[model samples]
Target: MTPLITDPLQPVFVIAGAAFCVCLMATICSPALTLFSQILASAQKKVFYDKFARQLATMATTLGVLCFTTMAAGILHTALEEPALFEGPLRLPLMAALGTLTLAFALQVIYSLTWNSLKKNKALHRLFGLFAGLSMFTAVFLSLGLKRTVLAAGLSIPSSAPALDTFLAVYSIPAQSVFWPLLAQALLAGTGAAGALGLCYLLLRREADNYGRDYYNFSTAYCARCALIPSLLQTIPAALLLWMSQPVLSPFALENPFVLLWAAGIAIPLLACAGWMIVAVSAAPLRHKPAMITAPVLLVAGYAVQMFAALRVYALI
Candidate 1:
């Protein structure tokens, strides 16, 4: 009698959403960091920023489209799996989430489309870019909050709970506790994701005739620096995520070998990849591939492990 979405393909959808979330956050944050990098950057560094900043914005906008689409589909699947949870007071949060998503999308689109054209009004353009990132954060925050509520409604409380709303309200206290962990992962992992992507792009262009050797070195260093911190911090939050889950100790979920296998088969390699990225990037201005280009492997593993684990925690399996 399992719901189709929850038991069958839900993991797939959630994993896809996570991947996009990582990409979107990374891309969105990159340009903002680039903007901030300007103040402290040398004249030579500033020139590099000026050339690539707009391209980052464009990439962010494109990634946002994929992020939102996958997220929307995930939401729909979750809603269909548990229709009752989305009905009452929860609807308010859902609507707010949609509102924030729409606003964020509009802002990002404008920011992307007008990147070069809006340079005439520097302050306004910067404001648009800044707000676009914030709006995205807000949207993700609200959506994840509601999702946690729905998940708790299904997995945490007794079936005889007075009302789903009340269960959600009370459950939210514990649920909200995980927000920091979630946010930390998104931001840090996003940065690492973006940095990894930047490395790939820079490595590809390292020998190109158009850009000077100095710019290449500068960009390689910058991207390496950006990738380093996130790679360092990401593992901590990821390790703590299950412990932070509301009602984390379900009888159904206890002592599951899948979790262990996932840890061994997936998380280990992911950590290795993260570590490799750090070491590779640390040796910055790398003219050739560093760390074996494991991003594709990590991406697939990330999608699978996250999807499988979430489904298990949510009792979707």
Candidate 2:
């Protein structure tokens, strides 16, 4: 069938699915990286790195399972609805992929638990990561493929796709016409993005050690500052897009496609540039032993953006 995304509800599926996939990718790949780092550390006879790697592997695995569960739940929830949470030729394929991801995540969790029970070593962690990687890769691919088509059908995506004209057309409204519910949805979602970014940062030091790469070492001192780099890179755009689109702005804006497109188009590059600059600064060569001081400052800045956007949206609503 021609994979045409038409329903207004399609954006929800697109956004949720994409978010799940991205989170899943991080969860899966992180463990493998952790395991690899452990091996590197072991070869160098570095106990600290090795221990950190083991802990990271376990944490990554556990978190992966949680993210997978959340994504799976989202997919299942969308799939089982009567009229269908979304309609498109790709829907079935997307559902099937999500189902597969769910199974992969479940299996990885089981494998990690078993490995942890058996022993604590690079081998066990590596094995678990290998399994998770398979699922993560699949989720990432599916998400990338479905993103534009899904959003074009009126779904949410990172503001990276071609401008969404038709979708915006449906939600067109004067700024003054926006309403409470619309603002609430935008604010809540944006706030969620900000919160998620914060959590991701707090866990970064542990996660980077999992990679056990020279870069990982380079990243350590900056951990305090660079911790939220990845999550911030991911979240800022989504939050801004939500703010600009004002889908909940009002009945009129909710039905206009142009505003949605404008929001997304503008937010994408801005966030990307901002994320890169922050990460670059954080990753810069420095002799700081503890990452605490710089990291906190950067994190606060990132979180502030999210908080401000959410509040602004709320006020508008």
Candidate 3:
């Protein structure tokens, strides 16, 4: 087997998968982000939730569209390369994932286009985002299920288990228990990125006298609180994934196809550091520390996780 990792077109997989990862994060976080932005008032802060919502919607929609198209192409290419990979019972799950993705794209487009025009109808706009978010969540849940099954197929696990039993067997019981939390990791990553960036913007606004220190502090604490628990809880699912997938993945390479695991290792601590600084800066009343120190680290590490996960999904080095 030629290492698919080294294929010339692997970069295409990287780019497409990277975009898709962002799409997943954005889609999952869109509703919360939109609502969070709305709760923040310009009078009390330097940012306008509607403006932030617009930017987020634009990003999510554009990426969602690209992901929808690119994944379609990528799937076709991979299926053609290895027809058996998609045959038998596997097609059902893959098709479900694809169908979910296609529907998400349409919802995203409609949501994005209506952003400006639907200013008066905030409820409907939010409704679109909410549906899209749920759809995106469903799509990702199905996709993760598919990845486990794919790994099982790649490892050629032999068993007399029922059709779906092979998948459950490969993915693991304890690991599956943390399914929603594992999924929430993406949401945490998304919120961390948005909150950290928004914090920076607000800090800059404070220096510019556009926003008050109190508002900045409040917002910092708010964002940190939103991300901290999920970041902490992610350790469970991360460990589960590493443990469960190791036996299946170890045969594929020498020492390193688990870049996603490595990235998660780096991120978990950075997230802790960032969370602490954010707390000191925003949550701590006695003494506020410099949040700027850890914020960038968190963003970079979070992005690394996202990037590594994309690479793993595409089997790209």
Candidate 4:
């Protein structure tokens, strides 16, 4: 029932963590969408490559830089505030997380900047984008594992091992029960958020760019499906995550109205957003403008609430 974070700087850390999550998800999704667009273009499909995919790549680079900076700043802040967290068993995993993120950011920038030059080498260019996404996903897994190791009690870190074995041990931590569900939940949520954001971006630009009705309609439908499918699929992992945390949360469940409210805050808006997106995709082109606009707003709001609630629960645990 009591608040977990009493520190005066707790608010600042929460804001920073939220910002990092948003930026990281956007970064991951942008590159993935870019790869999807490129595949469509390569197949001689009717995609607007320059306006849609290239723009997504650019956004990916920008968001990657932002995500990297935010993560670095967070690590530095943590090191300053709690130096012991970086000591002993925790050090290697944290380092690996940062190193992987750095690699992802570098690859993302190259992929974006070389898009034009790589026209003749589409395969290699796609590889760069692919690796960048993979790296980001890996980083997320490592970071999540490290977070669980830090928070959960009675997690043992192998000691007195050789350097290589130690590194492997740290990397393998996510395979344990505590971290995998969180990683799955994050990937699903990030994919859904990316799709929702893409839908909003397309809607905002559709008027000014005035791509033909057919193209605009296709793009809208694409983004809508992207947003809807993963979101619906996310429920399984979400339930698993909640189940995993029940031990920590059960004592307060009945006493805490806010917990239930936050849960509703996450689920209701996203379900409504998914319903609206269905309407947008099914209705006549641009006829359901309100649905198109409202879906993304609700999606983002739901995600924000979910992130806030998850952070609070993690702190409590």
Put down candidate 2 lDDT per residue, 1-317, tens digits, no spaces.
Answer: 21223455554544554454334444545544445555677688766555554454455566676775675576667668743434533444456556656656765666556655656654665666667656655554454344434444345543343334433432343454323323332333322232233223434554544545554434443322223344344444454445554564443363444334434433443343344344446544233323333333343343334333333333321
Roughly what TM-score does model 2 have, to 2 decimal places?
0.45
lDDT of 1 by residue, 54-79 (tens): 54555566767777787689778988
Taking all chains together, the TM-score of candidate 3 against the true structure is: 0.60
lDDT of 3 by residue, 168-241 (tens): 55445354543555566666665544444444444544565444556555555655555454455555555554
Poorest stretch of ten by lDDT in candidate 4? 169-178
Over 4 Å off, model 3 = 1-24, 39-47, 83-87, 153-181, 194-233, 239-317
List the candidate 1 regions with Cα displacement exceeding 4 Å.
1-18, 38-45, 69-88, 154-176, 201-209, 244-259, 265-286, 290-292
User: Across residues 178-234, which tens digit of lDDT does each residue of candidate 4 receive?
Assistant: 467667767876776676666667776667778878776766666667667776777
Q: What is the TM-score of each candidate against the true structure?
A: 0.71, 0.45, 0.60, 0.80
Clashing pairs in 1: none
Candidates 2 and 3: which is better by TM-score? 3
For model 3, the run of ten residues with the poorest summed lDDT: 280-289
lDDT agreement with native, every candidate? 0.61, 0.45, 0.57, 0.68
Candidate 2 Cα outliers beyond 4 Å, as residue runs: 1-26, 82-88, 116-125, 153-317
